[model samples]
Target: MTAPIVTRDEPVAGTPMLDARLVVDRGAFRLDLALRISAGEVVALLGPNGAGKTTALRTLAGLTPLHDGYVTLDGQDLDRPDLSRWTATERRPIGVVFQDYLLFPHLTALDNVAFGPRRHGLDRQRARAVASDWLGRMGLAEHARRKPRQLSGGQAQRVALARALAVNPALLLLDEPLAALDARTRLDTRAQLQRHLAAHPGATLLVTHDPLDALVLADRLVIVEQGRVVQEGDAATITAQPRTDYVARLVGLNLHRGRADGHTVRVNADFSLTSGDRHDGEVFVAYPPSAVALYPRRPDGSPRNVWPATITGIQRHGDNLRVQLGGPIDVVADITPAAAAHLHLGAGQPLWAAVKATETRVYPAAPGGSHPE
Candidate 1:
């Protein structure tokens, strides 16, 4: 952390948000999720497209009904399918910021924000005052008079956020809040949004596909895959130990499904690697791309994970070059540009790659679950 560039007051006390199970059936697409987000805390729902992230958000916001299970906030039953207890979207104490922002083009920034408070029963003057305060908090006070089209991408995003926060809801839902911005705008806007989310006293559920956004903005991550809770943990914990291949790829790790016994895991029918961490039954072996070393020949030493691969792709990765390979296990290797040049690396080139046993991590896939090789 470079001499902390920003500071925010501690979040205020608000009603603790949701602790619920959400189940919805949309024909073949069914979502079965269990989530708990604390007050004054931000949780990011991260997963692949159509992974039920948005569906869960909609359920929380009361836009979608539950097919089974229930939703509760601060012990208040929002939905109880078994009991037939349901709350309307407007009746739920929740605020939502949609992916496209959905700002009213006819209204100015201030009015857009005021719209929420106004709808919540605040008088015109009081609602405008609240909206003004939120705009100031978002650093968009001056843009308050501008319409959605008149504001820049970052400014519009801020206004949209302001609108959502103006209601002072117990739970805030943001669906791809920064997705509308460009790369440059996203960088700056992300920082700004982080500050506001930190100041929010209510629980926040952020839905995003970008790993950096989820890692930076949320206190915990709930990863759903194929409408199921695949993984859940803090950013650092999940980043360190990704249980699913989708999560491994999101965190930029080379992962393979395998069966483990002692320190060795058989990743494939013809391939097995020694791992420092011991596990039993079905397991996964993962290592960072940087852990891989390439050689022109089978320069073998003690690295147990060595394989012959053909370069399938090549691309610039930050200050280094990322070489993609196809073989027993498709893997990516990150090496310095100088080393790449020395090796004359290119697509279709055959090379040997190795990773020391200690560099790989092995963990049980699931306890008591069917062990799939």
Candidate 2:
């Protein structure tokens, strides 16, 4: 009998499951992102709307043509603009699950899952058997006869996933896989998707705008904006040190850019910072919303970074209230409702914001740091 596909880590020399140096142009938008994914690894491409996250994914899957650069999978060149080499989407060993879960409405779940294998030249009976096994693994065996229209959003998503996997792709691409589901269904579907991805031995690239999705489903995150990679690392590192305001907002941190002179950093001409650590160069200073303390008036104290600020807006964020304050620099502070009531904080209220020197962290800005809008 043929050996069962090994799911455990097996070193494959010079075998990066997915590698791309993609540069594509569309009118005014430009995407230049370099990405690499190893066998059994899941990487999430995250960014705001129109940030070229989807474009990058499509480029790798051979669905979108490259304006320049190349894509390689399992050491095979999929695209090389200079050499005039290009692989059609169907020829590339990649499977894509779209945001809408593009299943044939008339096809039964089993038939839908079997479609890929059949297209790949499997006999009808063999494809059906493989499809049945996949549906069984996904706990949808009882619903195999149900049409796509009869399935719930989550069930349809599972069917799409099964169809993609039945092809046994060398690289799996999921574009906003959980985006179309309701919150309740999304949570459940996300858990299921994670389990399946964990068991898949090939590289997976998930494209998402949701930070929660990236954190839970991916081994690493590649934050792209305007078609370029802004920051990339494991989840924890990205959360702690977000390089751009866009990333900071996604991860819920207050990010600032400034020029550092010893312990003091100047943010714009009007705002400056004094940190406990000394450095001399451009740097990024970041802190959580909770690190900021607001007062109705300038309190008489020895606080080093107290600045006069005005409440520009107030909104609820999760369990806490996020107060947007504007001064020499913009900042966000999270406070309890009681604190808001105690301080009589409201939109247009003048206040003082303070951050201890020790609470601020400074790090060298990455090359081509947060892009200018």
Candidate 3:
């Protein structure tokens, strides 16, 4: 087995900033995910719990041993199973920010940020100077002397980020970066983190379960389910046509399986829908929660597709109400608070739901098929 040498700055067509064909087997659980990230691009790995999002990150960071396949960063072969070559975590040009914001309790903010550079063999003075600059960039210059316990959650996160970036790695990995912050602090920290990530020249992979985080922070999204990539696309594309129930629930949409003939799609034998676009064969039909109109009994107006649905659950979504309905086809509807009050909407309430043909979209499912959740 010989190590494959990868030359940087050698232009290759369609070459990504970081390319990894990772396969890790751990007893019953196996992760086989292929990922690519362009330079300066941020790709968010979104999935539910136990979906292997963290496992993928760890494999890329060399924290988890690869059972097969290879990892290439900036064209360098970090790991290659065929060659029996593997780079140690410290040797890999990557930075990682854990969920808990792992900061030394005894070290100050500056010292925490300096630790990486110092370990990389930089002089103490130079490392501190680099750390100071990062702290300044994160707007934590005033708290450089503060310890982990002394700093707020948001502040500590920033310090952790600065520490990771101070080493100037080729790839940055963040695992649930905002999971530790409070609601108010999370919002503020998200914006701040976005700004810093925007300026980073290296590729970044953010692992988060939050849809808002993926939509706001990522240029593209990669949704994994049960150790497989279920969907990968831009926010608009993924949001408009979620490939799984988890994604549909995240984006607040009713997703259904149907067979399409032109613009009409039939679902559940009894229910058929007219979509905005024309398509044939097996398809997916999706409509946003807001597109559904609920009626107390039955409306007098023209209704193409109206189904008698029973409210299965109700919750507040932003300024509106998210009502989950069950019938021939399960659906979620978003109605205004006033409408909800007027209709006396609650769990187990009977209602009729209507959606405009133009509001619905139908497209062919992916080649491998839709995600089963």
Candidate 4:
């Protein structure tokens, strides 16, 4: 059996890379998020648009001022509102790659990457030498002399990453680094990026909306909603138990809040679910969409959880079809194409959805939930 995943509030072992409470206020919106990353660890920051993801990144990069709290990197105070201390962006030991791979259009790939080392006080010849080595490591040595416009999208992204890494920064910030590539290019680049990220010894923070990127590239995930941290944990723990609607959808799980009594959980006034686990008080019930089985009519079986549902929508999910059902309790179920054909699935089609008690997982709703550090 797998042990339960612990919360992020406790201190992380080993040397700390970036540790700070980011507090930035913009009119009605306020971003109050505490973030910590250990050396050689990559943490992914995921959230919907307007969830303060960009604000948090900007604050860390020194592009935006903090309304409160402080920014500490490598045991140095970069920003502290109480002490009235601020570090200029260039003076900070940090590197950032923007969404567009903001490389200088006129500069060659080699020169573009060398720019960072030059800014950090490296001489021209030495900076170019370091840049050439990095470009070789990224498998772009052949495109060293090509201009940004001449390079492909994936090539440009690699050059941008090499530039950021050439500075040997204490903290590396990536803001939607792979958002601009096409599907096929993104796949190839994602693998390359993962290798480079693993090699980086500095603390890394990746801000992205793609779940696949977070799962593959990050050591831990921090999910934010409404300018606050909602959940933070490893990929396995997060996928197994989601605490909020946004997180549930992010991980492709059906989640519900309810009061648990032994094996049964009362989700609402009209609906209740039975789980294999026994827990008391307010709890969260979660299961994968694949766990839900749909039948054209009520089957003659002792299924512990069954409900009458109407198909609200249907969409292709990979090789299978994802059916959205709405009734007493809204849920999503994944069925093979053959099963869909057998059930004649369509929007507004009525059916029965059932889940075995053994498939459900329950956990506390609040005490184990995310809290501000």
Best by TM-score: 2
List the pairs of residues colliding in candidate 1. Answer: none
Worst 10 residues of 2 by lDDT: 1-10
**Model 4 clash tally?**
0
TM-score of each: 0.91, 0.94, 0.91, 0.93
- Candidate 1, 42-135: lDDT as tens digits: 9999999999999899889988888998898866899998999998888777889999999999999999999978877777998899899999
Evaluated at residue 21, the lDDT of candidate 3 is 80
Per lDDT, the best of the predicted structures is 4
- Model 1: CA > 4 A from native: 1-16, 367-373
Model 3, 162-242: lDDT tens per residue? 999988778999999999999999999999999999998888999999999999999999999888888888999889888
TM-score of 4: 0.93
Those runs of model 3 whose alpha carbons end farther than 4 Å from true positions after fitting are 1-13, 367-373
1-373 in candidate 4: lDDT tens per residue?
2111112242246647798899988879989999999988999999988899989999999999999999998777999999999998888888898999899998999999999887767779998999999999999999999999999999999999999998887789999999999999999999999999999878899999898999999999999887899899999988887888888998899999999999889999989999998899999999999999999889878789999999999999999999999999999999999999999887898899999999988888877547522
| Candidates, ranked, lDDT | 4, 2, 3, 1
Which pairs of residues have clashing backbones in candidate 3? none
Superposition error at 222 for model 1 (Å): 0.6
